[model samples]
Target: MSANSSGVVKVGVIQQANTADTDANLAKSIAQIRVAAARGAALVVLQELHRGLYFCQQEDVDQFDLAEPIPGPSTQVLGQLAKELNIVIVASLFEKRATGLHHNTAVVLERDGSIAGKYRKMHIPDDPGFYEKFYFTPGDLGFQPIETSVGKLGILVCWDQWFPEAARLMAMAGAELLIYPTAIGWNPQDEQAEKDRQRDAWTTVQRAHAIANGVPVVSVNRVGHEADPAGGAGLDFWGSSFVAGPQGEFLYRASIDQEETQVVDIDLGRSEDVRRIWPYLRDRRIDHYGDLLKIYRD
Candidate 1:
């Protein structure tokens, strides 16, 4: 399709498999970003913690070494690539803020190779296999969108994708699109039916976010299986990375078990048209939402 009358932005999502080698992983990411740019993507987003495997699968203190400062090696490489490719890049990192302080930060690099802004993953999950709370400090930065050359991006991480409040807040704060860099998967022990339900629920919630907020949603998840460090069943990361339009329509979807770098064209002007018809934002009863701030009513 040619450029839309309302203007179009080509966004790319990179779904990749990570290994133990950090250098190799970064090289793979750089190569994928170049592929996306070659396909005419103006903005590209990599999977969560693309530098290595999902090390948060276990709460090993040794994982702390994975955290690096904002201006560290990863950002430097991504920034230079963004400049060279003239594309806005959203990258998730294990951020080493200070001594004993680290976060799951999503960094945005502008087309000029400078750090535009960042969003720390607000929702840290600590489950049976995915133990992230042990590694990341809960983000202090509120629900804010990072302004980029392409548009305002409401960047979030894996666990944060489940919360609708976060998406609404970003939409209210003028986010053009909601983006998630995620690393979620299923246990081998679970039944195939259960796994299908989990994957469906994951996609449904994010698409609902797009429908409710009148903004598009982009979710990029990792592919391949990472062995459990604690010697149990490994996780088969369901790699159905996808993009949804403002009306919650599927624009693009990647394979469940392959490394994909896909570029999808999003019409930014469609939000205006959809919002005018739905008007969910206009009909909100702000006075009754005080209960949302409470933990429980009963």
Candidate 2:
């Protein structure tokens, strides 16, 4: 409802760190969301795993306890808030789909406090510090856009942001915007130069997606250092959450170490104007892209 007929929408992004206290984290998110609503945001996005600390730093059986049903308590609370504010809310969570089956999921709450849709993270990474494969089942749901009151949302999770195919699939399916609820950062062992490369690469690729698809991109990330539960050096989550326009222009960018809520107004109608000039979609060589389905050209 915050979006007018002219394709102008005010979207909000919440970037904050989490702790062991899940209740406090949710409360903090709620308060920030209210602040965004006060700023006239029609849509609000939260960072990945906002419910608690980044538990994936180590593989522990107890971490499974954090997973809850999609329509469970978190949605109930967030949905109620969305209904009260008459806005759309997109939240990322650790989903307990079934016994012995869990997935990292992003749930979208409609203006009426109903479950609009959910996207289970497809790319589950098993890297050293990010041991997500231990906890999440690779998402079965294919790349698809969820229709909301404001527009069609292409919601992806933390690691999924790295893949162009995921973004393309969503954009192809008529998504108005690409959204990433992320939890990424640096390990203490990494050098400053390495960290810079990683973070810059992260932002650059997403901006490319916006330019290619002629749609805005929104990325929300947590900020601060989350320690490894296994008593090792932890990750310093660089919370440089940002929003970019269709031409890959920066709309709003957050600081690396602060908890913040920002509302940015975007003219969604501008995508059409941009696409008319660039016409990337019209020129795609679909016949030559069959090889993209393969793991590698070799």
Candidate 3:
């Protein structure tokens, strides 16, 4: 949107399994980032909470120890990498704000190894397996795009991907691409049919975002199965990280159960082309949407 014409840009998506070892996980993420840069990726995205296991499976107060400050350890390492590779990196981490204050935040590093901008996850899930409300305070920052050297990135976390309003706001604000750093999985004990439905629904909703907004969508999800520390049935993370074109076509999609790194080239200019044919934004009826503000219109 910022005078960037339609051109091919190589985007990287990483899907990896995580363990309880914080140091080990960080090391793995750093290594894959370098691999992506080597493969000519201009911008690379890591999965949600890549620095450690999905501790939200069972929230214990002590799990707060996993959080770190924004400019803290993870940024230092990733920022330096962004500078060395001269590539934009979108990294997600659990942020420790203050005494009993924390957030699930995504940080974007510039090409010069500086903090470009950050997005606190707006929607926090509180299901039985995902007790995120116990750990993260709902993000105070509104839905906004983070400007980077490459383009204006509409960054959202795992749960935020399900909401159309979140994606629409970012697109309305001139975001060039919708990027999601996600970590979602079903209970392994669920029926196979149920698992298929859950995954399909997740994929369909994101593609709908692309089709409606006429912008490309990039989603990076974690791989492998992480057991629940609470001793309940663990979740098997379906590793289907993918990138969709402005028309909701799959540019690239990783395996469903493998640690994968893929770079997909996309035309940033396609949004303009697609909008010319299907101009949903031009025909919106904002006057009739006032009831959307009410929690329940009885």
Task: Give the residue spans of candidate 3 off by over 4 A.
Answer: 1-4
Error of 1 at 180 (Å): 0.2
Tens digits of per-residue lDDT for model 2, 235-258:
999999999999999999999899
Q: What ordering of candidates by lDDT runs from best to worst?
A: 2, 1, 3
Which of the two candidates, 2 or 3, achieves a greater lDDT against the reference?
2
Query: Candidate 1, residues 171-233: lDDT per residue as tens digits?
Result: 999888899999999998999999999999999999999999999999999999999888989
The parts of candidate 1 lying over 4 Å away from their true place are 1-5
Which of the numbered candidates is closest to the native, going by highest TM-score?
3
Backbone collision count in every prediction? 0, 0, 0
Report the C-alpha displacement of residue 151, candidate 2, in angstroms.
0.5
State candidate 1's TM-score: 0.98
Better of 1 and 3 by TM-score: 3
RMSD of each: 2.3, 1.6, 0.9
Clashing pairs in 3: none
TM-score for each predicted model, relative to the true structure:
0.98, 0.98, 0.98
Per residue, candidate 3 scores C-alpha lDDT tens digits across 1-298 of 2623677779989999999898999899889988999999999999999988999988798898889999998999999999999999999999999979999999999999999999999999999889999999999889989988788899999999999999999999988999999999989999999999999999999999999999999999998888888799988999899999888999988888999988889899988889999998999899999998998989
Residue 221, candidate 1: Cα error in Å is 0.1
**lDDT value, residue 197 of candidate 2:** 97
